[model samples]
Target: MYDVVIIGAGPHALSLLSRMLINTPDKYEERPDNKSLFFKNKSGVYKTKVKDNPQTRNTPRQLSTYLRKGGVIDENVLNNICVIDRHGGWMTQWSKQFDALGISHLRSTSSIHPDAFDLHTLVQFAEDHRREGELLEIDGGIRGSKFTGPFIVPSLGLFWDFCKSVVKRHKLEDFVTKGFVTRLLPKDGGYDVCLASGDVIVAKQVVVATGNIGVKRIPGWARDVYDGCVDGSLLHTWDIINNSDATGIHTSDVCKQMVKLNMRNPINNTGNTVVIVGGGLSSAHLVVKAAMSGADQIHLVCRSSIKVRQFDLELEWIGRSRFIKLADFYSMKSFEKRSHVVRSSRGGGSITPYVHQQLVKLQESGRLIIHEDTEVWECNKDENHWSIQLSNGHMVDCYIIWLATGSIVDVTMNPLFCDVIKELPINIIDDLPVLTDDLEWGCGSGLYVMGALGGLVLGPDALNLAGARGGASRIAHRLKC
Candidate 1:
């Protein structure tokens, strides 16, 4: 039994653990008369002091000490929180998949680091017992509950070392990690977590930090056309990423197919030749990367023309500059004219002129082409290739396809908590859990969610590095209460 059982050992879960331990009270101190000390800000957005209680007021100090001692949250918090079909180690999997497909560089700059949460702190805690590249796999789940004391703290590796230090310093070791939880229920009380190996855990409080595990795939219409094709003709980007075994295809193969299709079906190609769908930084990067990769013929297909506000100005300026030479720019307005719409949750944004100038150079060399204001009606498979039909009655024969589609929050697919999520009344935002303002789930007290799953209300930043930090702070405050 555990006091708090967190599903998924991703970044979000680790951050939450750090916050929770920081809030637990020390044992040597006398019981403070103030309950307000337990309640901090709703979210960890603001810092507050325990007006009448000095013990609780030292929460920040506790956190600082933990950090200095090299404490980190658990790793199991992000189970299966990865791109659907990529391979490699963790974050590097997607990059490797792109490389396997002959993609030289990513569209966006790499910003994630192995020790993103402060390596110095992590190193300090590891007295050389464990270093990078060490794999620690724990096989078990919470089974019941027990009350160790008022202080409930869980530990893992260096994080545990720091917790032990804090406990010894505060004389609070009676609160062991093995049996600190009080009660465990199926839904509201806690989550009934069952691992793939048949181990089970009943936790009093559950925090689901699983990112995009239960969400559905790209819309059915999109999947139908992409997956239905034979000869590797029409396919989603995910299929390409996931199907690492598929061979004899290169990124150039995809580009060449698009060009041939346009030349064969000039009417469709001329009006809406290439439709690149998506509106994220990934999309913008793809536009530039494609142009740089010698793809002269292409079109951007999207749902809306409204660019991400923050990136719009930069992209627009890039378009007006040399980058426009790479490919023709089109938006939802252009596609609407063709009576077709590509479904994507992300909105279109602008690109840099530097990238566009490269496109222009490619076009001058007869290597780049552009089609704006085009809509795809349907995609089907012919003998060995794909036959793509546009709304304008023009058909394109291509050997490859790329679906730069986006992702969603999905909990149903996670093996650890699939049953737990199904039994809860948790609200769903685009198929993600709806969290309270304090980051706790409304369905169960002490249960919370973070990361991309919180995107509906938290905005687009929910999956980025900044979002992780914000989530950590928020969860920390909740534990304080």
Candidate 2:
């Protein structure tokens, strides 16, 4: 029995948990009578102790079923707020995923980290690594690149080291458990968390940060038209490459597969054709990686004109510096206006400044081709190759098709909280849950959401580190931690 239970032990969860710990009470002990609530719920449902606060009692019971939101959890809640994750340890599989994808650094800037007090934790991390020279001032330039002269991108190695340091400094490993959360059912004053390991956890508060585990979106167009034509040629970024049962999970199977293909047939061979669909930051990175990996020919198909920018939403939303602007947008009373603002701020097929330059260079050298303002309408698996027809009537074929189409946020895909969701009288819009002003999914239930699932209130920044910070701060304040 715990006060709060965080689901998913990734970067977002780490950030939230760090803040909660920072605000944790030196002595976290519930009253004698209140403490027994822990053992009382062993059968499945726990009768939670409620506060006498009117605002809390009237609050709804809605919660972001899948999220990793943060800030100073109640001190009494700290001891009980153990983290639950499918993968063992913190950020192990996530780091492996990035390594497999060949990503050099995160799209976010340095100020974003798990430390509740240290906004410059990552920046300080780079400095401590004797890589101060490699540290890029995130301003007036690309999100993660230097502002001037030689554009320096933080190597993934540096980022991994920093993550390890955070986990170590916070002693996060002690509070984590390995198991996939199969379902969450609300009863009495709290929720019951069921895991694949045949264990049940009763939590008064919950934060879910499952990174859309195994949930990939490959565009309904291709799936509905061609059935078996999309077999071996298609792959999603989140899919485990080779399905390794190794210690940590890897989300870079597509990148590794393409690299393997490039290894078998070097660029000089000119035999293999690799087509990459979607043009977001992931696709942008994939294009550079695929071209450099010796793929004979690479085609980048984007539905919209490739918009080059630092971050996905806007230059202001980077790091918490300009986050106030986003908060202002969230305050709007008009849902239509809010939806429009979110849609207009979206940078769907956008690439970083450096990747934009790489695309230009690739095109000039005739190594990579860009089908801008086009989409893959149909695909047919041919004899050891894939035949693809673009929305613009263009046709091409490739040995493999890596779809960087991104993840699906449709809450229906994830049924872990179906029982809980049904019991809550919460409103849903656009397949997203409606949240309160403080980003809490419900008012009094102590249920908060972060990541893509909290987009309704966090706006476009919900899934990023900045949003995690904001969510943490709000929840911590609510808990008076």
- Alpha-carbon RMSD to native, per candidate: 15.5, 11.2
Model 1: how far is 233 from its true place, Å? 3.5
| C-alpha lDDT score of every prediction, in listed order | 0.41, 0.63
TM-score of each: 0.52, 0.79
lDDT at 134, model 2: 54
Q: Local error of candidate 2 at 7, Å?
A: 0.5
Question: Candidate 1, after superposition: displacement of residue 131 in Å?
Answer: 22
Q: Model 1: runs farther than 4 Å from truth? A: 2-6, 9-189, 214-222, 230-232, 246-276, 284-300, 303-365, 392-394, 409-422, 426-432, 477-481
lDDT of 2: 0.63
> For residues 328-372, could you state the per-residue lDDT of candidate 2 as single tens digits?
553466665665666566756577776688789989999788999
Q: In model 2, what lDDT does residue 152 have?
A: 37
TM-score of 1: 0.52
lDDT by residue (329-371, candidate 1, tens digit) is 1111232221111112223444333334444565576544333
